[model samples]
Target: MGRWMKPEVYPLFAAVGVAVGVCCMQLVRNISTNPEVRVNKENRIAGILENFDEGEKYAEHGLRKYVRGRRPEIMPSLNKFFSDPE
Candidate 1:
């Protein structure tokens, strides 16, 4: 194999990775600093008897019991990380 691909391929992949990382970091920072944004992820429109049809839906507790919405309750570390400041 004589130079399987252009030398630019590695750099392009690195650039894409950096871009994705930066975007993810910014998203995390935004979610952390804004409670309104976090609140938007909670459950508000569903009633107790409402039937869900195998799709994403929030419960009255703001998160679904069956593993949803980053599920901090299921992970102690995440729960601590997302704890409201005093």
Candidate 2:
């Protein structure tokens, strides 16, 4: 009754599904079975550590921001940005 895919192609679709499932299972095993990865996973801040540098990086950056001529570009038009007049 369907026009897009033939019934005979169902086996090919099932084979692709099984292949993808096997790849996913292997990926999970690779991550979960690693000693280093396991240690990282057990950490409380692992998720945050993935994207953020350790505190020392920020300490140096903050110390440098007070150099003589550096000005933070504080937003110029705060009222225009927040209020849309009707």
Candidate 3:
């Protein structure tokens, strides 16, 4: 097996596996949480022509919930270093 695959290739394989796993997890999460996705048979036809504003609001709320209380800057100390004098 060592002859067929080099040690350096292992990191590449691991990176690819991690990326694929993250993509699959995100796909599942989006399908499960998205309000626009109607999984039920009855609700699909009943609200086929319903307003999309509610769904947009729900998406916005979800985004805000995730970003709540988190700092917007990636590196506050680095940002402060180059700022104008107070």
Return the top candidate by lDDT. Answer: 3
Return the TM-score for each candidate structure: 0.36, 0.38, 0.55
Q: Give lDDT tens digits, candidate 2, residues 26-55.
A: 678556543334445356455444433434
Model 2 CA lDDT for position 34 = 32
What lDDT score is found at residue 3 in candidate 1? Answer: 73
Off-target runs (Cα >4 Å) in candidate 1 are: 1-6, 40-86
Better of 2 and 3 by TM-score: 3
Please name the candidate that would achieve the greatest TM-score relative to the true structure. Answer: 3
Judge candidate 3 at residue 7 and give its lDDT: 84
Kindly list the per-residue Cα lDDT of model 3 for residues 2-85, writing each as its tens digit. Answer: 774998798989999999999998788677766767788876877755667867775677568888988898888888888856
Per-residue lDDT tens digits of candidate 1, residues 1-86? 44746786888878989999999976885565432343342433332323454223322333345456554465777667788554
Q: Between which residue pairs do clashes occur in model 1?
A: none
lDDT of each: 0.55, 0.60, 0.79
How well does model 1 score by local distance difference test?
0.55
Error of 2 at 85 (Å): 96
